[model samples]
Target chain A: MKGFKTQWSPEEADRWSKEDYLTFVISPLIYFLLALGAIWSLLLLWYGWLTLGICGLLLWLMIKIIDPKLKAISLDYEKKQKEFLEELEKIERWEN
Target chain B: MVSFAWLDWFWLVVFIVLMIVCGVLFYRLGKRSLADFFLAGRGLPWWLPAASVYATHSATDTPMWVSGVIYKYGLRGIWYTFFSAWCAISAFASTRIFRRSLAYTQAEWQTLRFSGLGAELLRGWIAGWQVFMNMFVLGWVGMAMGKLCHYLFNWPEWIGLMLFSSLCAIYVLAAGYWGVVMADFQQGVVAFSVIVIVSIWGIVAAGGPQQIMAKIHSLGESWRLNPLAFSGWTSGDFPLVWFLTMLVIAVIGGFGMGTSIDWYPEAQRIQSARTVRDASYSIWAGSALIVARNSLWAVAVLAFFSLYPRIQDTAQYEMAWYRLGFEFLPVGLVGFFFAAVVAIHISTISTHLNLGASYATRDLYQHYFRPQATDKELVWVGRVTTLILLLGSFLYGLMMKEITQWLIFALWIMTAGIWLPSILQVVWWRFNAWGYLASWMANLGLSWLVVWVLPEFRVIPSLPDYLQFWIMMVLGALIYLPITFLTRPEDMNRLVKYYVMSRPLGWWKPVREEAIKRGLIKPERDLIVGGQP
Candidate 1:
């Protein structure tokens, strides 16, 4: 939380930053933890619960770090999406 | 053969009707345009496409595949199904980039990413291959259902294949992806609930979790409970090296598009989401559900193993989870289980029917043949292509018995040789269309040589799959890297446009600098915060 950028301008969010890098690290760990945790917990293993709890914390942290950037990116991107879509059609039809 | 009571038949018929009706209700929405037909108008609120992703990947043969691995290797087998974890990083990485580009399919993305003849050729090749691959997958999955039905009711495999796929086609043909996604939601719910019920039932039938563990220990197989248990560093079937290789492939591969075959259908889901955030969450949550679902099936298979430890035959043990349901669930619930199976079957069928058609209609038909096709006409083309794919699947399903091994080999070649190139095409701006194309061609020939031809002639030993992956990757780079440097990079204008749109991660500094120089984007130091620069 200290180092991760929580707030972003549209242009700032458009560029990859430490928040994105942190997410790249955190997201996969959450998946691995969720997977093994689900299996072990179903068998009533204690460590399984702990693993899942950690996974939850990491998931929260990941969202906190990346969600703002994504929101900014999405908000700014949607404004231009119509223009982008038009360009896409031109490419599809070989008119470009 | 298992006998279904009248109640069983009732549940089956009711579920079929419900699924078809749910899908058909969206016919008007699907007929609105090509986007509506293929993508639900790209306005879905994350969860719909999330459910569709979960349901589509949970095909009829999924449990059988899961059961086979879990039964054979205990907890370690979950790693075998862990390839879907690519979505983990992809949710934040490639998924975001692809969502921004807004290509209808991966094939279409090619022409958007590259320019000129090479790009066109790549698009055509990928589109044709996707059409063929989807048909092949449909046949393979349909035949799996046919085999299960034959096993259950002594019905001919063809009847099982034709009956259910055609039934699924009714909704897909009527409503296209709207039908596919909506029905997938209902089917995802049913399939997931049934999976939980049957797995818990199987656990309780094995005298609950504690007793199952005790039995496993008493049977001197406690290692089965340890997820970290490995046979050896690299020699045994469940090797540490192989597990590490899988982790690299699954997790790191997420940064690239088309790294996993699952990315094709997922590309549709990615575009269907209303926003980039929605696209990211849908892929992440959907695959999160899959990871958890596989764990559920793993535990259930372990329960079956504890109950019947001496079973040695692969085919018999592969039916572990299904046997847990039909052999153990009560009479009326047996029908419910079968109905859920139908749900699982058709969810996959509908997705492929629409997915293959998306490639056929969007990339091939409209892009190449009928660029002037209207939205209404394109929607009709989507339907016609869906029908064609369905019919093609039935034929492939009927003949699948003799060609399964070869097609699987074909799939392996598709992944192994081009894995790095698929990633490079995203992260490295210098990875051009000719380089990508050359990788495919080189991999096709080299895979045959390394995997089969040389081994057959005693020129080399039969290498392990993980070893083959590394070898083919190095070998493929030998060809593609030279071709990449020899050929000029993709047109700067095209690269700049893609860079501005996608903002792709990794090694894109040159493109970013160009975009900045062109005043297309601002330098990071000039960023305005709170509307003040």
Candidate 2:
């Protein structure tokens, strides 16, 4: 009876939510690499060096590593917000 | 220097009488209760509140600053104002968020959201900072009016400040927000009249608007297009990275700061609306005033350039314009301009004092100091605090050695500090209280350290100053977010009770249902308000 109506468990949220994946798991390891990559990329662009390929990779890394979410609200804005807040509230409730 | 003749003084007396008469008229217009005092008793229709916001924001400093910025930098200041125009529209579009909280002040949203003892304590201190800054602005406002008066009539500086301060104080004391609201209409008319007359007079003085623009454009490309060019903190012929930082701070960060204060007058105005549309319209309409008032001042600034092309100091350039008006305006227009100055001063100062006292008395004192105080007592506290704030502000001004760069840094950007993270917390889900607090502290601390230590360390980065400011903001947010997630958003449950009362969560149902019915994520919790977290 509860099929669709059942509340999301913390495990389910952690597994399915993109924010959980992007924020918790992937973020820390990428932070330094991204900033360094941007610097390298810019230097390569100026030199017209074959090294530009690595520079491109670094610059792309920097842009991705920055919280793309804060740039502007995404297309799935309201839907994502609802899910995020719910997952957050659930997380808060669990800690209590 | 043109002086105020007897006729000019007579016109000034007449304008004062009109403000007092309007206040008296409104007092008798069934506005005697507490509602009458603040939020115009929440009964003001859309146009009245809208007009009030427009007029109140047009402080004596508005035109003064405009004249200064234009004469110094050309159209850059006007271009930047459009950024604020975007902010106003952004606030209007986000009405769903601002109106949902239904609190008296933005700080109330903090207490409402995080209902823990710890959060409330944090709330009180943050609230105190806002009240202090609001009052701090009030002190400067008094000083501004005093200076205007001395320029207008050759009155003693202290005498002018006294007259402006006492008038605003007595009216605010007599009618509270009620006097201010009605006085707002009178002031708005006077301000608009002055703006119209001044613009016309200025154009005629400069030959014509087209001629004025042409003369202004002749200065140079740097004067014509560069926002950072006039600021003088630039690299070799170009503004350094700091200018880029200022642009970012003024635009992206400035939006957040302005939005955070969106609902400052609180429940009074919110409750006044017959519908949500009315409430939103009230503010949007108020914003419309900004468009014209901005243009009015910009025109005056252009006029200044046309009239006097080579004064370098920004303040001197602006003073020369106002002095020209006093020296040259017709007797009738002189009265209007004179009245407009007082009108601008009263409208702006009254709102600041009321807002400051509201923060100190309602948000700080009532929320923390004496939570159980009666309504009458709270009202008395608010009124008393207003007087105390005025005196305190004047004293602070008297004691200052000079407004140091640090003071300018804080004064210009503290609104951004409080605003950016606070607004971002709602829009950016990764944001948490810890992140908000850390970024808030870091921005101020780093800015302070930059001033104190940067002068010593001498680590000039590859980027310009403006760009450096942006990098710092980005860095601060980066540092804060991880620390926030590490701490957990779960702490926000402290505010759950208040959230439930205002906007109960749909338990992710809104998202899942929308997505699933449309074939995306699986449906989670159904549309049950309190079904789950």
Candidate 3:
């Protein structure tokens, strides 16, 4: 537990970058759109927009609800980890 | 009936020799510990795992399966594979979570995240089912490769199965995860290049892409290009609604719920990634490759339709890609093409063998039997388990005749049943071992009732495959909820530990508060006013 860390270490969150946002945000959006657009186009081509529209609307709703929560939870956890590591370091210095 | 040229043999021999050499180089690396054997010491760069993930999905039968779907339904048939685009959820959400869990296997994650006898039971259950699923996949791919050998050389299918099983087992048993990844990298590149090349050849043979499109246009079967166009219910091809239903299941059920299902080998890759970012990128990169590969196959099948317009038999339709390989590839390259095909088979089989043996040695043997076994003893157990699993899969391959039917059950039906439970395990704190077990059992029994028994009895209208899967998913939820509430909750300490460690962004309000009080973590920036309750 003393040295455990994740790629999104809390110590770096204060210095989060445009690149981080782009990688975490734009990249996934572009990728999913490219993948899902193939399906959407196929659906529209064969079954019309009614089917595609319904799916698109539902997916939009799910993403809207889920995305912010995922971001908040990740940030919260990283912040806690940062504090936890600092606490451990303080204890070690006192013992010395 | 395709015959390989001498150069094909030459390429295959070379491929095998190089693969064995990789096995020997990595042999010492794998002998260190269970982690080294199963997870490559978590030392792989992103691209290696990315390539290995792509290679694992490109089993020998993948092209045949794609060709068959296209022959029946057109290019839209690509949707069937792309349905796994649900993996996009994995790339986004679960990659970091999986890395943070720090569990050896998905089964082992239960102990990390849960508590007491219930977590133990849950661990054993997951480990057992995963082992069974891995063996079945290994055998299914082995059978397909054996049949391909028969198609190419008229050799006894068993001989080819034996050769494949023996060679793969020797390397995989010796070198473990290092061998699996390195071999997968080499094989994935060759297999990908060969498929693309052969497909381009087919396109040229049919006077290029424009001519193939023109030929399709002349036939007035443009419906093939539309991914959503389904033949009517009685036509055997799924209907339009079924396609939509599958999309919903793939997205909502697959992503919104348990994005991290028991894709055991893929899970190993995620764990093996050098960083969490590497794990995330690997999934997206691998999926992009799969998408590219599917498109290439679709184009090849389109050309096949243009060249052989009258071959309508289903069996011949499925084998049309192979026929194209034989007809279009030149003598010297024909062997190279066949070798690439063998490479695909070996990559897939090797991963399954290595993954399955890990589950047996770690979760089953070590956990229950020799909890204090030395690293040397564990690696020995892993090697023996690899050989035994390979032998079992070889026999299973021999007995299977209809590879497609078994594949459907393995891929869709089995997954649908377990999907909900897997999701709940991560997100919901109250979901205990009994709840998971009941969900699995209920999905199995109810799925049989819907897919098989009801149809046989004509109790109601026989549903389409997609409908049946969705219904079972709903039924799984119904079964899980009651069992979870009725069962006692897990030990609270374990719950808090998992909560703070994994930090799963779900319904863990109490655990977070407790973690703060215990000095496990500081309060959040936006904590409630006067938060120390």
Over A1-96, each residue of candidate 2 has an lDDT whose tens digit, in order, gives 121222333223212234323322222222222222322232233322334345345434433532232222212232344444344333223333
lDDT of each: 0.92, 0.54, 0.71
Please provide, for model 3 over B66-97, each residue's C-alpha lDDT reduced to its tens digit, 9 standing for 90 to 100. Answer: 88788877876777766666556566555666
In Å, residue B418's CA in model 3 sits off its true spot by 2.3
Off by over 4 Å in 3: A1-96, B230-238, B253-262, B526-533
lDDT of candidate 1 over B1-533, digit per residue (tens):
79999999999999999999999999999999999999999999989999999999999888988888899899999998899999999999999999999999999999878888899999999999999989988998899899889989999999999999999999899999999999999999999999999999999999999999999999999989988899999988888998998898889889999988899999999999999999999999999999999999999999999999989877788889999999999999999999999999999999999999999999999999999899999999998999999899999899876223544475577778988999999999999999999998898889999999999999999998889889999999999999999999899999999999999998988888999999999988789653423
What are the iRMS values of all candidates?
A: 1.9, 16.4, 11.2
Q: What is the DockQ ranking, best to worst?
A: 1, 3, 2
Q: Per-residue lDDT for A84 in model 2?
A: 40
Interface RMSD of 3: 11.2
Fnat of candidate 1: 0.75
List TM-score per model, in order. Answer: 0.98, 0.72, 0.85
* Residue-by-residue lDDT tens digits, candidate 2, B1-533: 34666777788888888786666565543235433455564456666766677777777666666666556556555543432342232322333344444445556556545545535655676678767776666666666666676665567656665577777777777667777778887788778777767766776777765576567667553365323344455644335444444434433432232333334542345434433345545655565456545655665666667777777765466564465567568866676577777888878787777777767766777666676566567667777888987777776544432222223454334543344565565444335556766776776766555544665566643444354455566667677777777875534334343333233221333333344565443334532332333
Q: After superposition, how far is residue B343 of candidate 2 from its true place, in Å?
A: 0.2
Worst 10 residues of 1 chain B by lDDT: B402-411
Could you tell which candidate, 1 or 3, scores higher by TM-score?
1
**Clashing residue pairs, backbone N/CA/C < 3 A, model 1:** none
All models, DockQ values? 0.70, 0.03, 0.08
Q: Report RMSD (Å) for each prediction in the order shown.
A: 1.6, 12.5, 7.2
